[model samples]
Target: MYQLAPNIELLFTEAGPDAADRVRAAAAAGFDAVEMWGTSDKDVASLAGALQETGVSLTSLLAEPRTNFTLPGTDLGPFFTGLDRAVENAGLLGCPRVVLGSGIGFPGAKRPQNLARLVEVFTEAVERTRGSGVRLVLEPVNTRVDHPGALLDRTADAVLVAREVGSDSFGLLYDLYHSITEGEDPAAELANAAGLVDYVQIADAPGRGEPGSGAIDWAERLSVLRASGYDGPIGLEYFPTTPSVESLAHIKAVARDA
Candidate 1:
């Protein structure tokens, strides 16, 4: 069975704004792991305490300020500063990974040029974060539905950038929801991405809701993921149309046997 880390930002809001309480709630609900977007606004002390008390692992968190390398003349100082902060917080939370994004591309810049810029920026990022014990995973978000005009929308492109960065510390976050929403086949993309994927996340397509709320074949997709050789925890990064626990029933059942 695969371990599932629910995204607390979207999963346990019923526990209210303090993510520390959400960590406790998730632990009570039998989740041993959770993920979130950013830590800038959170009480790190409280969060760390809760995780320690509950023994729940923080699987991943976002790299803040999501630097847009495609934008010309963009100041990178703040981006690097934010990354340092992210690494610090990850250390406090015992998180293993930090998710990075391409941000929206600079208007009228060629896609290749944008991707090349991403390579340059991420190469430096990987080098900077080396030996921190926190792996950096670059995510390719869907531009069509949720993130319009996002620079890295294709899984192949993300894999290429990860390849160019050429470090085990730097790898890809192959989000299945975003991939399907972008009209890519799961089997094919997972095959192409292969061993480079260090993280994975999921939501059903069309509505971005919990699995079974949309058209994806969970068993088939999970099988494809297994075949692709990624044994890491999968982040449940979907919105719920029902109560969070109820929303998980479908994927939980499917994943248990997958």
Candidate 2:
């Protein structure tokens, strides 16, 4: 069996149910850790209580209230406020990671300017929680299907950004499905970015379901991750074409047998 953490985002039928119940259900189903989206579906305190009761750790959560991909140089007062609130909530839940996605890219804005803005925003975020022990993870989403306009689409680009910031508190989330769908060789890309990668999430391409549900060789890819020295928990941020429980079973099987 995989001796790592997993998020509960894949288990939800919708974002409509109680967050605590979702965490409890994931724990009951045998996940060591569970990550949640923003505080939209439910309150953070209730989710924290459920985690405490089940003894499951809140692995990660999203920084919310950011409507657009406002870079650092622009007006980011609102974005920083949301990030601070998210950091505080993450600290409360005892979660060590916070997945931070840059806002959508604006074609009108200059590339250099946007990159500079991102560095500023991330640097500020790192500075806010100097001793909190929470990592602000930047996720590069695939612009093909789900998120078509995300700022950081390439893993290499994420690594560059992380290197520019040069802080342990800031790192990359490295979603495999997005990287694969965007035509990146996960192994080579990850190898090139081994230093900046802090967390890794996985799902098959095309369908965004569990491993082995699509054409991707999940076992080979996972073995590559293991060989590459990434022992972090793989986040299951996928969409279930079928029911979630069935998909979860498939994911567990893949992890156990791979």
Candidate 3:
């Protein structure tokens, strides 16, 4: 069975008494590893302390100032600087994965030229972090519901970019919610991009909440993942309609039964 890590971004809405307290809460709730979103407001020292206190592992974090720097016209220099900081922080926090987002689509830019820019940028970023031991996860946000105008909305397209970039340190962050919202069949599409998918995250299709809270069958989906040989942690990335602890309790139970 693939291990699952709780995404602390949803569970702990506040920074609480201190960052270490957050790690305690995660452990109390039965999670061994914790993940975070944008680290803009976080104090690195406190988070580092928390990990030490609770023995909770820091799984992954999204690169800071989460913006679409991948758009054709946006300057990539600043984005690269932020990414470098994220890499440095990952080393301190013991996180193995960093989520990378591509900005929006350029209305007038030629599609192929824009794609080439993405390839070049990702290749350079990988080179800079070659010795850090942190892998970059490129995610395709769904343009249909949440982010409209995102350039890398298709999993297959992102896989193509990964191949073009030719970096073993970079790979796709296959998110099931966005793929379903955009009308892509997860099993079939994942099959096509089989070897290229490095990490997989999931949420129910319509609500972007916990699986089994909506129409998607967590059991069947997980079966597909296991059959396909993806033994990575199943990331719980979603917004909670109620308090995160309660919502996640349901998710844990469902995942257990599945």
Candidate maximizing TM-score: 1
lDDT by residue for model 3 (67-142), tens = 7465445777778888988988888888898998877744566767767778888899899899999999888879
lDDT-superior candidate, 1 or 3: 1
* lDDT of all predictions: 0.90, 0.76, 0.79
Model 1 lDDT, residue 116, Cα: 84
Query: Mind sharing the TM-score for model 1?
Result: 0.97
Task: Flag clash pairs in model 3.
Answer: 68-103
Worst 10 residues of 3 by lDDT: 11-20
- Relative to the unseen true structure, what is the C-alpha lDDT of residue 68 in candidate 2, on a scale of 0 to 100? 34
Tens-digit per-residue lDDT, 148-198, candidate 1: 878888989998888888898998898999999999998899888877899
lDDT, candidate 2, equals: 0.76
Q: State how far residue 198 of model 2 sits from its true place (Å).
A: 1.5
**Per-model TM values vs. the true structure:** 0.97, 0.91, 0.92
Model 2: what TM-score?
Answer: 0.91
Cα-based RMSD of the predictions, in order? 1.2, 2.4, 2.0
